[model samples]
Target: MDLELRHMRYVLVLAEELHFTRAAARLGLAQSALSAQLGRLERHLEVQLFERSPRSVTLTPAGEELVARAGRLLADADDIERQLRTLSRQPTAPRGLRIVAETIHPEVVNALAQRHPGMAVTLRHDTAEDGMAALAANTADVCHGWDLPSVPLRMRSGIAQATLVDEPMWAVLPEDHPLAGEEQISLAQLRTAAWVSPGPGTRRARHLLSVCQAAGFTPDIRYVVDDQEMVRTLLANGCCVDLAPPRHLPEQGCRAVRLVEDVRARLFYAWRRDSVPGWLAREILEESRDAFVAGLVRRGPLYARLVEQEPARFGPLLDIDPAGWPAARIPVPALVSTA
Candidate 1:
């Protein structure tokens, strides 16, 4: 039995919507027809992808794995179609670069747009995990991600990477919290407090767990949220304690303290070692540096003060000198294209 691309797409949409009626409505098909299609796809794969109950539908482990792979496949198909269309219109269309980053700074995209008027550039905001997957799947030409060095990223083979930012994580707490008055609070000190977490299985959550474990106790994570602003709000309202990079400022009700532990957060720029052209890699690195620096500058006086107070903690930004706008060019390795 063979499964068509439409079958995979159907599974993806169903997995997203989780409700037969909603998925069917989105697909413009009757619920019964959608159910029949799902049944056919499952039979073809010989695996039950979802758990169905009167109240809800949820993906099984197999379904979760398939959804991830299917997303990459669909992105790759779209990229190929776009390239073919571009070539059909203009045989010598300028080469394209697709970047997948957790948060692509608009300044970076705009800078690239200005510098390389003829080249095609696309930036996608996806999770770090998805961004790396897209690079491995050839759907993205570059990926930007962050992780603790101790929790080393599990990179796919043939990927080349360069470190863009190396900075420290700061503790966020209500101004009146006992440890908030301290200049540097150790992880062990916060063990008893309810914490804001990024949720289980995510890199941020796993890193927090590892750090806490190293400090001799697992964190008491009371809330799981993905929004940084929500985390700030929680800490400010005396709801929970959390962590963020130094770039975060303590607002009126909360304080951003230094973590005594030596854990460092690193940001990386990566691309497929075999396929990326040298010129493209260099250009991307330069633009990324500009964007990173510009973002810090935009953070205003508090950020600049933090950087000044702890230049070593800020790493590469010391070289950035956003105010002075340093003239020296920081060199990145030229890619050796194997394609």
Candidate 2:
């Protein structure tokens, strides 16, 4: 039997609550009915996903994995439903654009709205990986994020991407940290420092790994996290160091220093081929470039120096070649973008 979306949802709720009674109540089903449905689901998959006792409930290892997969599946399903609903509306009605981004400046969103009075834009924030997944699944029309020379995002097949801004990565150190006063810091200089980073195997994590390996030492990752704020907090406390482009400098209690290495971060937007309207897409690209560049140049100090040093490099952008996608790019002046 094919597993249904509803069955996955049932499993998700049960996994979260870890109790049949609570999950059933939340789903508006009786305890017995919920149990019967779970039994059918288990038989269909031929796997016992949960271990239950009179006293408590817990997931089997397989259950744990399914819970994670279910979340992505459900999100994609919801995205598809939303897109269908929007498409089913009057063809001449003002169309809505759903954007999933790790970080999109407010000025860009405001500018897009101002430029296209008829377009409805929705911004949803998520991790870069999840945002790309949404774009791939057709839940979102576009995703905005940064692609670094060290950590290029893995684009899903068939997606077309355009670069908007290029900026340089910086070492984020405690305000009083020894290297904090330096205008630039070398990767080798940071080799011995404790680091906080994204989880292993993620594109960003892998990039950091490669960077460290090239620097002749491994990063002593003291914390594995997905939250940028947590990384900043750890760095500010003098516990560890993290990296960001100059545009995404730590908000407080840390200093940003340019890296001597040529690692660059390119701000980019990816969408399904032929999904976005030509006018709106071009407007988005233009506004993204303007807003990003304007912010960096206005932010002063590091921003001014970077633009002054590499103006041509930040001008007009290019798309990732579909054949090699993120791994291959047509050579141009290298650029890095801030958040």
Candidate 3:
């Protein structure tokens, strides 16, 4: 009979065990059966594969060579089997997409579910830098975050990006603070006041420094914290003031006042080059924009007052005219308290 994979496996096991009974047990066969099979295989090739004595068994020189070759052959065969299994599943398996971002609104997730019901979508929270790294490693399909000019050129290369919103930044102040009553605050007016900045060495920190410098004074940053709740606590306690975008809804103890300076924060949707199709990327961008607008509209009277008071600044956000600003097509659910 022609040799088969089973025969190679048999010889390899026997060579390692060096005992017919032990090798047979390992192979889940009776000792007599293993011996008979090997004997037939040897007779077919006219070779003595093993030297046997009543006390012990050892491999012949021919057996040694055969075992070495069998090891490599078995490895290759196993690899082929694994590859074939993977190929077999490709046709039937559903596609999966992963998005890395600081936050993903529930509305966006629901919209994607309605658009591509079969595609599985996973959301993970990470900084913009780490999110881009995930995209480069092919572990994530997209990233959503601020697009600041301070980001490294190396990180920007080989990535496709779409800008979702470009809006003015706002000053986050304690409700009891002196400047908090103002509808708009200038950076220069608060240059001497204590400030809460993000962690040093981060892109946000650098951007804050640059914006402060443009207003003619370095920020007197008294606290460096990254957690939003902690920052809000500090502001609520009247410890310091911070800058945030309009999308960052004001909390109970804080107010979001528009900055007099023209400084703006840009929101971006990004993906690796050729990793996501152009059409799919655009769909995500559009969905994200709509969800963001819906959130602003749902921010209650505080934002509504801003839209009414500063029509030139906040009016474009709610413009429903088809030619001016695109309104959300997806249904906006009732406002849920994030507090």
Query: Per-model C-alpha lDDT, please?
Result: 0.77, 0.75, 0.76
Clashing pairs in 1: none
C-alpha lDDT of residue 255 in model 3: 77
lDDT of 2: 0.75
> Cα deviation of 265 in candidate 2 (Å)?
2.1
* lDDT by residue (tens digit), candidate 1, 62-160: 899999999999999999999999868753323677888876778777877777677688988877788888987899988887856656776778887
Error of 1 at 296 (Å): 2.3
lDDT top scorer:
1
Cα lDDT of model 3 by residue, 63-142, tens digit: 99999999999999999999999978653323777889866677887787777778898899877778878877888888
List the lowest-lDDT window of 10 residues for candidate 3: 330-339
Listed per candidate, the RMSD to the true structure in angstroms reads: 25.3, 24.1, 19.1
Which portions of model 1 show Cα errors greater than 4 Å? 1-94, 249-252, 300-315, 321-339
Sort the predicted structures by TM-score, highest score first: 1, 3, 2
In order of listing, the candidates' clash counts read 0, 5, 0
Number of the top TM-score candidate: 1
